[model samples]
Target chain A: MRLQFILSEIGIGLRRNLSMTISVILVTFVSLTFVGAAILTQGQIQKFKGEWYDKVEITVYLCPRDSTVPSCADGEATQEHINQIEQVLESPEVSPEIREVMFESKDDAWVAFERNFSDRWWFTEMSVDDMNASFRIKLTDPEEYQVINEVLTGRAGVEEVRDQREIYEPLFDVLTKATLVASGLAGVMLLAAVLLITTTIRLSALSRRRETGIMRLVGASTLFIQLPFMLEGAIAATVGALLACVALWGGVHYLVEGWLGQNMDWIPYVTTGDVLMVAPWLIIVAILLAAISSIVTLSRYTKV
Target chain B: MIRFDNVTKVYARGARPALNDLTVEIERGEFVFLVGASGSGKSTFLRLTLREEKATSGRVLVAGQDLTALSNWKVPAMRRKIGAVFQDFRLLPNKTVFENVAFALQVIGKPKHHILTTVPETLDMVGLAGKEKRRPHELSGGEQQRVAIARAFVNRPDILLCDEPTGNLDPTTSLGIMRLLDRINRTGTTVVMATHDDEIVDQMRKRVIELQTGELVRDQSRGVYGSSR
Candidate 1:
């Protein structure tokens, strides 16, 4: 009847069955850790996609000035060919698709290449005249890059078209699949945890059969007899969830971000700040998982 | 008052009935001793009054409610009006003596103030006021049984069904318990004790019902414990 009395009984029940209580907590913590890992990994993948998608451009490298191809027969990109490409980019139909465009001359391309590969010997072999100038186009729709590529390629001065999305797709695919695998494993573990929790509660009930029988004989309601067992499970689950959130937070912050940040700075936005941003969600998920499993197990097994 | 009309109870998958075509009546404030050896339907009769086991083919009425027609959910409410003492004492071992007696009132959702007053009063009534802090295991056999009596009488139930309340005590201790039951009976609580202590039954000279092989052989007021002595 009193909240304090009920809670005290729950505490006693948990203490009396310490091993089973710890088992429930550990099971919940492990399952929720997997769940938290899956969620964080999915968030990281999304963050990478958003940052890379924003900076990614369609780079159309033109024929070289000293080439022997039909596009470069004039020994350089002709003014008339440049005018035609600019006209197509400025057109109302194409303007809506192309958000912004920038041109790189041969000298600019050589300078960029030199800056990128300054430590390598390959860059010393290429002169300014050997470099191919290109137009970098930022598209309005990342998914519609194929339409822009079709319109640009085979034009007078364009030699090749490349979309960066195709280059990094396999990596994102693997991360996404890893998320699915984690979630599948978590689902199975959670189900097992529920069954184990139920068994634990049933065992607790059996151990205190005399107390329960006495309670029933004295006119204690079924709910009154059952609440302590339910509280036992819920408390264990909640403790487990709390443990999981801490474990996941440390795993993401100290291990993944700490090790990976030092090795890979080229990839932007893979930071602990982002992981901490979703830490509250992990805690909520842990508590919810514990609460749900507790309710389900107690309702089924501890019916006084 | 309690009444059983041709009450018959056959346990699951059992050919013979535990109580066969039995009829009995107990008036309010009456002290009745149900005497029989083991498996003689003494326990079955007490269980039927508490609605723990139902009669198979007859009507059982306790305090004006038909045990057969009452829903399972209403059994607890019905039991609240009756007190039961078990042979094992059934005191919650983890609880202190005070808590064990207080639990009887607490379970029924009695107000905190009422419990604060009534638990001590009931403990005092059972002569267990000074030992309220001790657990059941710390007490002697008779003392533990006294605590159970306190728990039973705490709510002031209209009827008390005790299945071998003195089964575990020595004869001298058994007489003390019998005197306590008699004191409770004088307060208008119908006391039904199922026991085989021939000495107390003969000494009290109360109404006795004898059963043999699940059949009532004798029913008499002021009956001796057994016919032999």
Candidate 2:
């Protein structure tokens, strides 16, 4: 009976302030969506960094025929120059840091160049002599790339030493900054949401002051008078949170997994699963928002 | 039972105390009217009796419990054993008469079965049985006051504190309300009412306590309401 009475009171309170309730729902939804989006974006960047970083390799571009590069000024690398570089890469001291070193000959480089630049007529006109024979060194640990770079670059046959991770760092930085901005906005919006919830509850309580006063006169406890108002806020915020979850699920399922994944298949994107992972936190935040607002405002309005 | 021992309630610092150096007692089943002009501390007497305002320098006891010493949380349980009514008939405008009475029981954690049986019985006792489905705004002023009284009395409290329960009613309605109070008093429930109704007090001929400037000027057992007038 107590539960039923409180539930009915909650319903009445919500209905009495319908517009305020909707605004509360919208505010909560937008704030929690940002929070969910920020978390998922961070998770996505980590997944990309973990998966792509493992496959990142250091490319030791070797001297090519007719090359004018200073590192290759010794002229087209002979078999001895190639053997010297290969031996240095395969030596026991360097081998411990290197996972697997695969050699790319002039012919193999030419094949890749033709496939990539076949649409450009001026590029396909040249022979395989312009292609550099390179040693692709996969590292045991991506963080130890500088160790291999120090050993390989500036050698007689080496033209350049490049860690593949550097090429992706700028992209990761942009994504990380985007998530940070989103998190900052989420923080501001969450504060606004809390304040809005608090104001809405205070207004609702003030509008029903007569009811509460009578409730007190009839010997109603403080909790009894305040429960209905607290539940009103919780209901609004929980609905907002659920709506946020739905928005996040749609964005991940359609935007990230569908369009972005289809366009850039190699880049791992966040999925609906990621949204689901963050769903509980969003709801918990929503409930906390309501509870905090209630705790701050209810005592003054509903106190016996 | 209600007792006030040297009670002084000062709402603001360095201001006139609402009740000053007061000591009074009403037995378990007595019907007493607290009478005075505005600011004579008549309302303060009722407020202190219900512990709505703590006395600044003395003890106010109700139903054998010292309200001045009662903790905040215990006020609810203590209030449960006492019922209060107001001059304006403070009923929820949206709720029906039956719901208004049932709400009193519901807030006290009474069982559904008990509320179901007792609410209508109490409404019937207050002469609003057939009007249970009517809202407060839909009822007449007298009927609205009946709903408030039914709500106050539904819990079968040890004491009924009516603070001008008929203050908004006409003379005939006020007489009816007084008769209803007399009936409730006969049920062995102590009743303390504060009113400016000189006619009702003189006609009822019950004990009357008159206050002037926060001081008890008269405490007359079965006396008229004219000693301090």
The number of the candidate with the highest DockQ is 2
Off by over 4 Å in 1: A65-124, A145-158, A256-302, B3-8, B13-15, B20-25, B53-60, B66-75, B107-113, B133-138, B209-229
Tens-digit lDDT track of model 1 for A1-304? 4676678778888988899889888888888888877888888788888899889998887877666666555666766777888898898878898888999888898888888987997767877888888888898888889887878777888777889888889988998999999999889878877777777778888887787788778777778778778778877877887788788768866777777766786675445565566566655665565467657665655443
Q: Model 1's DockQ?
A: 0.49
| Residue B217 Cα positional deviation in candidate 1, in Å, after optimal superposition | 6.1
Q: Alpha carbon lDDT of residue A231, candidate 2?
A: 90
**Model 2 lDDT, full chain set:** 0.89
DockQ of each: 0.49, 0.69
lDDT of 2 at B52: 80
Candidate 2 regions exceeding 4 Å error are A77-128, A144-156
Candidate number achieving the greatest TM-score relative to the actual structure: 2
On lDDT, the candidate that comes out on top is 2
Worst 10 residues of 1 chain A by lDDT: A295-304
Tell me how candidate 1 scores on lDDT: 0.84
